[model samples]
Target: MVRVATLLLLRHGRTTANADGGLAGRQPVELDETGRAQATAVGERLRSVPLAAVVTSPLIRCRQTLDLALPQAEPVVAEGLIECGYGSWEGQPLKKLAKEPLWPVVQQHPSAAVFPEGESMAAMSARAVAAVRAWDARITAEHGPEAVWLACSHGDVIKAIVADALGVHLDLFQRIVVDPASVTAIRYTPLRPFLVRLNDTGGDLSGLVPPPRKRRRRAARTTDSDAAVGGGAGAAR
Candidate 1:
């Protein structure tokens, strides 16, 4: 049987930059008050899932979100899952950046757009996908084929990973929407990957839980007279 694993991609909760409408990029900004509540709510939403591992981006905002959402799990920092480096645009107002010519390319043709003094969208997608796949393999090997894992990362990073899982081109990745403190599930199998859920914030996930193992029924013991009858029938045959 092909081993299968489920990856729960969670976007970090709202941050100060998010509230201020600024691009946080890789800044060390922490989650805001409302973000804390959102984190707690999402944590409660996923309480039923038995996560094998909780992975997170190296960014402080993501780390904080992971801690708040899954307090018991020690988050494993995946450097490759960090947010896209916005470089010069870091901490800038989104409204101003929206007017720039490069912004259109970023939205429509992300495959060809490059952040000034930073990284390209394609590079970000490559690294994020690789990191997710690596963790999927590790979790499945360690926890079994039905293992479920959580990866707490940024919005753009999660979008990139989702785009790859859906086999969508990097240029079209902007069409995908990932909100703060949302959960998206992707199940990886040897044959093909399945997108179980996307941007789910208020849905019950009891269906995602693995079904209970079936109990094997023991064969009834045959009495001596019954065995003798069976032997006589066999001799007659």
Candidate 2:
């Protein structure tokens, strides 16, 4: 049987920049109080799942969320999963950026968009997807196909990964809404990838639990009379 691996993509909780509608970019921003509460709620929601590992972006916000949500699991910092650098636009307000000529391209045609003096959306998508695939393989190899792992990262990063899994073009990535501290899941199988859940903030995940193993039934032994009758019938035939 082909092995399957489950990946839980978690967006970090709200940050000061998030609340203020600023472009956090690759800035080292910490989670706000509301963000912390959200992270706690997410942690409580996922306490039942047997997470094999916790992977996260190297940024502080992502690290904070990982620490709050999956405190017990040692997080593996993945630089490739880091947020897209907005360059000169970093720490700027979204309202301000909305007036820029490139804003439309970013929202409508991300595949062709590039941040001023920063990375391109295509580059971001490629690296993020690569990082996720690598982690999925590593976790499945170490813990088996039934293993589930978490990846806590920025909103854009999570969206890119989800888009790749859904086979959506990067231009339509903006259409997918990923809220703060939301959880999305993708099941990677040999045949194809399945989007199990997306943007789920509250709900029971008991369904993700591995089903109980089925026991094999043994064949019943035949008595001496039954065996003699079977042999006589075979001889007559």
Candidate 3:
């Protein structure tokens, strides 16, 4: 069984559309002042970690977020990580969209929700999950299993990725909340992917780093991919 790299899913900060209560959906919406601040704050929190790679959605908002958050890193744009296509719904107010007949299906039955002349919610989840897993494997192979990477994406995309890691059904993904600028961490093993952190807005990230090579080798001998019997002692400080 091959060890996989840790994936850091970062939802882009709030955009102008978000502030105005509209759905940005694949629009070229940029970040607002508050969003820039959020990106800066998250950057400070991640400044110390040595990230092996940085990937981002092709959306402008996501690129803007990564610009402010990790300006020193070169992030690759992944089409699979882009926002879900909302078609005619793009740029519409959330309040107005909620009144549409399709809204209920989106909230309660996302697996079956397909936008008018746009992509299906299930399709979005599938592509996002596939992109993340493929990247994780590639990073692990190239940079070793201890590699840590980041992916800047939209809220729904991150939520879908998180749901997949948790083994939750796509229909129930609405229950997951991925706040703007929040970071979610997942570690994939041969057996399963572990959700280490979820919706973390302002948390110490030093704990996410793996132990030294010698210590890691020793720890590997004592533990498998299986979860701790009773939530075993957390990551090494």
Total clashing residue pairs per candidate?
0, 0, 0
TM-score of each: 0.88, 0.88, 0.95
lDDT by residue (1-237, candidate 2, tens digit) is: 344678999999999999989999999889999999999999999898989888889999988888888888899898988999788889999999999998999988999988999999999999999999989998889998778888988888888988998888988899898999999998776645767789998977656654543444556443211323443442111
- Could you tell me which residue pairs clash in candidate 2? none
What's the lDDT for all of these models?
0.84, 0.85, 0.90
* Best model number under lDDT: 3
Residue-level lDDT tens digits of model 1 in 159-236: 888888787888878888999999999877665566778999888865665554344456644322132354344211
Off by over 4 Å in 2: 212-237
lDDT by residue for model 3 over 134-188, one digit each (tens)? Answer: 9998998899987899999999998899899899998888898999999999998
Say which prediction, candidate 1 or candidate 3, comes out ahead on lDDT. 3
Best by TM-score: 3
Which residue runs does candidate 3 get wrong by more than 4 Å? 215-224
* RMSD (Å) of each candidate, 1 decimal: 12.0, 11.8, 1.9
